[model samples]
Target: MDFKVFTIIATIVNFLILLAFLKHFLFEKVSNAIDERSNNIKNTIDKTNSDREEAKNLKIQVEENLANSKLQGKNIVEDYKGRAEKLFQDIKKEASNEAELIMERAKKDVEREKEKAEEELKKKVVDLAVILSSKALEKDINEKEHRRLIEDFITKVGM
Candidate 1:
């Protein structure tokens, strides 16, 4: 063979041997490493997506709970308002009842006072009439005649 041909053939044989050796020893291990790294990346991305979804669900649940709590608070406030109104009405009723009772008692007291005043007035009038009759008769009678006349007047008035 020519020297150039022999050198080229030798170079080609060397390259083929190197390729076979790399295929047998290095390719599988390197490819397996790359595949493992890719799988790890995919798993990490999937876990991140699932975590995000879980966080969103938790936020929604929290919002729902807050809304329910607000509704409950509103209900409690309304209940309190109704109770307060009822209490106010009850107080008004009680006050009115007390006022009526007081007015009735005052009226009874006034009626009793009027009756007592009328009796006192009747007694004064009777006394005044007796005094006036004595003055009117004083000038017209001697003592014995006054006694005799008074007995006659008394009998006629009694009859």
Candidate 2:
């Protein structure tokens, strides 16, 4: 071959060796670094999504607890109302019983007073009759006639 052609071939071989070295040393390391950065970004995104889901679950749990607490409060109020009604009924019954007892006692006291007054009246009537008979007998004395007059007075009085 010619001298010029030999120089051109050597220069082409040198350019190919330089391209191979650049591909092996610089391009591979830069590509690996880029891949590692992409993987880190993917991992961070997954972790953020997991955290958001956990927050959502916690909110739902809190709402459920609030609803349960409200139900419990309502139940407590109903229970108290029932208890109060029962207590009021018991008090009313007791008052009614006491009033009945007081009325019965008053009636018994009135009956006893009536019996006492009747006995006193009967005794007074007997005494007055004796006095009247004694005064009349001093003027006209017959024992049978006196007894008959007293018996007639007693029959007219009826007691």
Candidate 3:
């Protein structure tokens, strides 16, 4: 190759002009596009983290609601059990009172029947006594006189 001073200087000047043009037009636009893409990626990551945290909080709230529902169900069952026990006790007390009334009525009926039987026996004894006295005093009395004497004796004995 021929070593020419003027040609070397001209080539260096052309290369410097091309570098300045590329820096002003192509490089500047490319660098701005790359920075915009990096910013978009960072915003998407932050949004994804926020959505994941919201989902975790929702899951915790649902679990707490489930536990509260279970406790309410248990309380309802206990209330029903207590009401059933109270109803059973009331029925038992009513049955006991009815049985006592029946026993008292039975006792009154027995007492009335005993008194009626004693009165019937006393009337029979009175008739027997009158017959025996008439037989013992037979010879001393006429028919009309005997009847009047028996009436008088019965009146005195009744009093």
Candidate 4:
């Protein structure tokens, strides 16, 4: 091989010019493309993290709502039970009052019947006494007239 110093110098100058051209055009575009890709990846990662945080917050809210719902359900059930108990007491009191009214009415009925029976017995006794008196006196008068005379005499003495 034949070595040429001038040719070597020319080749070195050509290589430096090619490196400068690549740096200005191809290398700059490649670096810009790489930076754009890195930015896109970072944005995607930030969005993913935000979505994950939102999901976690939603889960926590759901759990809290479920707990509140259970508490409200228990309160509702307790309220119903209290109302039922009050209703039961009111019904029992009403029944008791009704029973008392019935007993009082029954007692009044019994008293009325007793008084009626006593009135009937007094009338019968009066009738028997008037007949006996008429028979003992040997009066030929009707029993009714004799009883009327006795009644008039008693009334005059009493007044």
Measured against the true structure, the TM-scores of the candidates, in listed sequence, are 0.64, 0.61, 0.58, 0.79
Scored by TM-score, the top model is 4
Highest lDDT against the true fold, candidate: 4
Candidates 2 and 3 compared by lDDT, better number: 2
Off by over 4 Å in 1: 1-17, 20-25, 126-159
Candidate 4 lDDT over residue span 64-153, tens digit each: 999999999999999999999999999999999999999999999999999899767655665776887878887777777876766675
Model with the higher TM-score, candidate 3 or 4:
4
Deviation (Å) of 142 in candidate 3: 17
Model 2 accuracy (lDDT, Cα): 0.82
lDDT (C-alpha) at residue 150 in model 3: 56
* Stronger candidate by TM-score (1 vs 4): 4
Estimate, for each residue in 1-159, the C-alpha lDDT of model 2 and write its tens digit. Answer: 456977888999899899899889988998999999999999999989999899999999999999999999999999999999999999999999999999999999989988788767765665566567678555755656665666677769786
Q: Write the per-residue lDDT of candidate 3 for residues 1-159, one digit (tens) a residue.
A: 899999899998898989999999989999999999989999999999999999999999999999999999999999999999999999999999999999999888988888788666655555555566567756544556655665667668773
Off by over 4 Å in 3: 1-36, 120-159
Clashes of each: 0, 0, 0, 0
Candidate 2 collision pairs: none
Candidate 4's C-alpha runs over 4 A off are 140-159
lDDT of each: 0.82, 0.82, 0.80, 0.88
Superposition TM-score, candidate 3 onto the true structure: 0.58
